[model samples]
Target: MLTVGLLGALVEARRSLELSKPKTQVQWVDLAAPHGPVDLALRLLGDETPAPPSIDPGLVATWDHIPDHGAVDRMLQQALVNAYGFVVGYTDAMHQVCRWIQVLAHPMTQTTNVRALLVGPTGVGKDLVARTVARLGRRASQPFVAINCATLPRELIVAELFGAEAGAYTGLARRRPGLFQAAADGVLFLDEVSELPLELQPVLLRVLDEHAFRPLGSTTQIAFHAQIISATNRELASLIEGGAMRADLYYRLAHVVVPLPSLAERADDLDLLVRYLWRQVDDSDPPEDIIAEVARRAWPGNIRQLRGVIERAVLLRKTVGSTSSLLDEIKAAPAAQPVPSGTLSELRQRFERDVLVSIVQRCGGNIRDIARELGITQRSVYNLLKRHRIAPGK
Candidate 1:
C-alpha cells in the first residue's frame, strides 16, 4: 500500500510538469502595433503552433470602452441599444451609427417625412437598425412593414410595393394592399434596397416625389404616408453606373445614411457581444473560457455569424456539460492554415487582394456590393480592380 501511494504521487507530479512546459515556442508581437489584425494573428499563431498565452481570461477582460462625451445623447443611444436590441460596438464606425441614431431622435415637422438608409456588409444588423428607427418614430403604435426586395420575383416586386387590383395578373384573384399602403402613417423598411428592380426605379421615385402610388389596373392613385427606411449591402453609386439603379432614386432614399462596422473591425467588442449572445441562448452566466476562444477567431460573417456559432456552442454545452470540455472540442476541430507573410507592402497588397477576392466571391462579383462592403468609393474599387487585375465578373 505504501509503494502504490508513492507511485501514484510520482505519476501526478510528472503530469503536472508536462502540463507546465510550454506547448509551443512562439514570440510575442504587440497587438497594438502598426500591424493589421490578420498580421497580428499570423505572428501569434506562428507556423502551426498553438495559440499562445494571449488567450488568457485577463486578455479577454481588457476591452476598450466608449469614453464619456459630456454632452453626447447617450440616453437615446442606450435606449436604442438596450431597449430596442440594437447592439453596436465601441469602434468609431459603429459609434457613427450611434450618432446617426441620436440624430434620428430629433423631431421632424409633420410635412417632412423621414427617409433613412443603412449600408453595410450583409448581416451587420441593418434590419435591426431599421426596425429600431421605426420603433423610435412618432408612429410607434402603427404598423412597421419590412420587405426583402431581393427575394421577390421581378414580376411581383412592383405589385408587392404598390398593390395590384383584382385580376391584375395571373395570380391576382383579389385586390390586396401593398406594403406601402399597409404601413400607413408608420414605417416601410425596404431591406436589400439595391435589389429593387431597375424597371421599377422610376415608379418608386415618383412615389417619393408625390407620396402616392398607382395600383395595377387602377386609374386613381393611393396616397402613402409611411416613412421610408432602406438597408442594403450594395452601393447605389456603382449600381447607377451599371444602369441597374437610378441616381434620382438614390437621392430620394438616402436622406440620412448610416453605415455599420463588421464584427471583425470592432474586435474589442467581442467579449461583450459574446456574453450578450450567450445569455440569449442559455440561462446560465457566460463562461469566460468560451469568450476567450471566440475572441481569438476572425468572424468574417460579422455579428450574425458570431451569434450563430455561440448558439451552436450553447447547444453543444448541454451534452458536454462543462465549458472546459466544449472549449477542448473547439480546439480539437481543424482550422484553416494562415497565409504566408511577406514584406510590409506585399502583406498589405496581399490582404487587399484577398479582401477584394473574398468580397467579390461572396457577392458573386457585384462591384457595387463589393465597394459598399469594403467601405471604399466605387472609383477606388475600380482602381484596385485594375491594380490587382481582378475581373469584376470573378
Candidate 2:
C-alpha cells in the first residue's frame, strides 16, 4: 500500500533522475486533467497546475528546490585537450561522458563494431560509458549482455564465452549457446576484463581479428558482430610490463579508451550529486549544510562509497544526534591529496593556507562563522586571509 508520504518520496526521487537528463529534450507535454494515473502523476510532479489536495507538502517542496545534476554538467566548459581533457583533469568528465559515447554510437562508428576500453578505479561507474552507448546507439533494439570475467570459473570460462558442444567439457549433457551468440548484433560488456586468463587472450585476439569464433567441439565457425566494450580497474601498461596481460590484446580492446573520473576529482559537483543521491535514497532534500560538509570531505572509494554513507545517514536520521555523527565522519576523514615536494615548514604553511581558503570560500567570507568553525579569533582569520591572498566571502 502506498501512503501519501511514500508516494511523495518516490516522486522526488524520480524527479531528481529526470531532471538529470539532457535538457535539450522536451520533457513536458499538454494533457487533459487528472483522468488517469499518468495525469495524476504529472500533477504530483508539479508539471500540471492545482496538484490534488492529497499531495504531500514535501512533494511540493521537491519541485520548489532540488539540486539538478544536468545543470552542473552544462556549467563545465569542454576544452578539447589531448585525451579530451584527461591530462588536464576531468573537471568536465561527467558532462563529456555522453559526448564520448555519441561518437562511438554514431552510425559511422557503428559499422566498424567499435571496440571501447574503459579504464578507471572500481565504483567510478566505468560501466556507465558502455551502458549509455548500448542504450542509445543504433543497436538499442538488440540485447545488451554484461559478464564479469572475475566471476567466471577459470576452466569453464571458454565454454561460457564461445559456447560448447555436448561433449566439449566434463559433465556436459547438451550443447548450449554462449553469451557471444546472445549478444550478436548488440553490445557485449566484459567487466573486470583484467581478470581474464592469460591463455585465453590469444583466443579473444583471434576473434577480434577474424570477427568470428569457433565453439568448442564445433566443426564450423560462427560470425561475430557484437559491439564490444571492455572495462577494468587495473592499468594495462603496468599489466603488460608485468607480463600479466598481453600487449597485443590490450591494443585491440582499446580502439577507443574512455576514462571516468572519481568523486574526489569532482569537487565542484558535490552539491548537485549530494542532492541527486539524497533524493535517490530518500524523498526529502538533504540539508544544505550537509552538502557543504560533504564538499570539504574526502571520498576515497568514489561515488560508490559516498552513496553508502549517504544512504546510511538517511536511514539513521530518525535517531537523535545522527546529523552530528554524519558531520563527525566527514571531519574525521583526512582529505586525499598527492604528496608534494617541499620543506616541512613550507608544506605545513601550504596546508594551512589551503584549509583557510576552503573555509573562507565555504563560509561566503563570513568572518564570524570562519572563526567559530576554525576555533580561531577574528583577528587570526583576517591575518590568515591576508597571508594567503584570499578575499573573505565566496
Candidate 3:
C-alpha cells in the first residue's frame, strides 16, 4: 500500500519537477527508516547509556497544611524548609512567590482572574501552588480543577478543555463541559503545557482572548471567570522558537512566572519534605539521623523519588518489625548516575544531542515536525540526522 501510494505521489510530482528543475538531473536517494525511541536514545547517548529520568507529573502526596516538597507557595512551608537550607542573608529568589501569597490574600486571590505560570523541574510541587492559593483564599466555593497536558489524549484534548455535546465525538455520548467551564470562579491548572498539541494552541488562545469558550457542538458560550495556572517542566521558549507553541498563548498564560528550585538545590526543603512524607508514612516523629541520611544522597527524581524512599522505608520497616535497618533501606536504593566529565563544548554537544533525541522521540521522527520544533531548516534537520547519526521517521 505504501509503495503504491509513493508511486502515485512520484508521478504526480513529475510536472512540478520538470517545470521547476528541468535541467537538474534526478537521482534516486535512499533515506533510512525512522528509528524507535530506544534506538534514538542510544544513538544520541552514543552508547548503551540510559536516557534521562522522566518526570511523572501525576505523583502527589496527601498534605493539606503547607507543601513539604516543592510547595513553596506559603510562608509556613518556606519556614518549615528553612531548617537546613534557607540562608538568613541569601538573596531570596522566591520572594515573588512568597509576596504573592501575602499580597493576594483571601477574597481578591479567589475572585481575581490573574493567570500564573510555574516553571521548574519535575516534582517541584508546582501542582500544590494552586491548592495553596485556594486555601489562602479560604473559600470553599472556589473549586480546584487540574489537568496534566502530558497525560491527556491528543485527539480528545479539545473536548477535555472546551467540553463536548453528546455524540460530539465517536465515544463521547453525553454532553459535558470542559475544564474551563468546570473551573468556574476557581483555578484551572494546566500542567506540562509543552506537551499540549500545536493545533490546540490557537483554540486555547481564542478562549483566553475572549475569556469564554463554546462547548464542542454547542452554540452557547460560557465565560471563564477563573484563574488559569500553567506549569511546565519543559522549556516552552524553545518550543516557541521551533513553532510547537504559540507566542501569544505563552504570554497569555505566563502572567507571573514562578520558578521552583529543584530538591537538590533547596537544603531546607529536604527537612520539610522528609518530615512531611514521614508523617504520612509513619505515626512517630521522623528521627533526625534518618532525616540526615535522606539529605545526604543525590535525589535525581526530586520530590517523587524522595517520597518513594520514605514510603518504601515504612513498608520495609513494617516487614522486619525493626527500625535498625531503616537507614539501610533508604541507602539501598541506587543513586543517580554521575554525569560524565568533559570540556564545556563537549558537554554542550552531549546535551544538544540528548535534546535532539528527545525531540525526535516526541515528534516520532517526523522530518518536518522535528525541523519546525527545532526552528531550523529541513536541510539542517537532515544535517542533524547525519551529525547525530539518528534515523528519520517513526
Candidate 4:
C-alpha cells in the first residue's frame, strides 16, 4: 500500500510541471507499434533580426546625372587634337630659322648683342618666321612687341619708340612707356624698318649704341635691355641709297639678314600649310585629292593667299560634301594658272603694262588705285593714266 501511494505522488508532480511549461511542436514515431504515432511541440523564441536597408534612389540618380566633360573642356580637348595634327614641314628657310633659334637659345648667345633682320616680299611669312624664332628661343617667356613703323606717322613715331612722361605734351596726361621700354628683357620686333622716318633714325642708332634712352620730357635716362628683331619687305640697301634709311642704322640692323623665300619659291609647302589650316578647321583630315590640288597651285600671295584659298575650300567642302573634284576646280581658278612663257624683263614689262591698263580702266582714266597701291606720295591715279598714255573706257 505504501509503494502505491509513492507512485501516485510522483505522477501528480509530473502533471503539474507539464501544465506550467511552454509547449514546443515536435514530430515523433512509435517504434513498438505497427502504425506510427506523430507528436507536435512548440516553444517560445526571441524576436527576428532586421536586414540591411536599401540605398536611396535620389542619390543614385544625382551621380548618374553628372557629365564626364563640360563644353569648355570639350573645346580645349578639340584644340589640342587639332594642334597635334598640325604638320610643320622641313625647308631650307625653315631649317635656317631653326638654326638661328637654336643659336639664340645657346647660353653664350643670350648675353651677346645678336641682332637679326628678316627681308622678304610681302606675305612671305617674314614676321611669322621672326616670331617663331622668338617663340623657340631662350627669351620665349619674355614679351614680344611688334611695331610697324610705316603705319605710324612721323610726328608720333618718337613717342611710340620712346615713352613720354606725364604732361610731356598736350595729349600726355599719364606717364606712358614706349615699345623699347615696354619690351624690357624681351624682344621688340620692328616691322617695315625702312619706313621709319629719317629724323627718328638717330634715336634708334643711339639705342643700339648706348642701350639707353630718355622718355619725352624726362631728364632721367632709362636703360633698355631687350633683343631687337627688325623686318622689312623693302630692299634695305636701296632704301639707304635713296636716303630713306640711315646707312649706319642699316649696317647695325643687318648684322644677320634672313631672306625669306616667297610662297612661289616654296610651292611644296603650300599643300602642307593648307592641310595644316584644314586640320585646324574641325580636326578632320581633308581628302587626299584636295591636298594634291592645293599643292599644284602657284599661290601668288604666298602663305596668306594659300590660307585664304584653303579656308574657302574647307567651307565649300562642308557645304557641298564633295572634295574629290576640288583639285580641278582650283586648277581652273584664275590665279592658279601659269602666265605665258616670257623672259624676266619681258614678263615685268607685260605685267606693268597690264597693271597700268587695268588701273586706267578701273579709275575711269584716273590713277588713284595705282598711286595708293604703289605708296607714292605725289602721283594721283589721273597722273598715272596720263603718264602711261592710256585712255579710259576704250
- Please report, in order, the local distance difference test score of every candidate based on alpha carbons: 0.66, 0.68, 0.62, 0.60
Per TM-score, the best of the predicted structures is: 1
Off by over 4 Å in 4: 1-88, 319-329, 332-394
TM-score of each: 0.65, 0.64, 0.63, 0.62
- lDDT by residue for model 1 (209-307), tens: 998999877888999998888888975765676467888998899888887777756776777678667767687756777887777766667788778
The per-prediction CA RMSD against the true structure, in angstroms, equals 16.9, 16.8, 24.7, 31.8
Worst 10 contiguous positions by lDDT, candidate 2: 76-85
Off by over 4 Å in 2: 1-90, 318-321, 338-394
lDDT of 3 by residue, 1-394 (tens): 1111111222222233324322222222122222100110001111123333441223312223223423322222233233112211111434345445433334554456667788888876777765655544534367788899999988788888889999998877789878888888777888898788888888889888898999988888888787777899876765675567888999998877777766655654566567677766687656787788777677877777778878877776678865657788667755534446897478657887898889999999898998878776677778767887888853
Candidates sorted on lDDT, descending: 2, 1, 3, 4
Q: Native-vs-model 2 lDDT?
A: 0.68
In model 2, which residue pairs have backbone atoms overlapping below 3 Å? 364-393, 365-393
Worst 10 residues of 1 by lDDT: 33-42
**C-alpha displacement of 388 in model 2, angstroms?**
35
Off-target runs (Cα >4 Å) in candidate 3 are 1-96, 103-112, 138-140, 171-173, 323-326, 332-394
lDDT of 3: 0.62
Number of the predicted model whose lDDT against the real structure is largest: 2
Cα lDDT tens digits for candidate 4, 1-394:
1111111222222233234323211111112211111121111111131211442323221212334313222332233222221222434554454445445544455568588888877887767666655564567688888988889867767777898899888878899898889888877889988888788899889989998998988999899877888999875653554356789998888778876767665554565566567766756766777777776666667777767767777887889976546566687755455446887568655776687687656655544545555454223445544555666554
Model 4 TM-score relative to the real fold = 0.62
lDDT of 3 at 6: 16
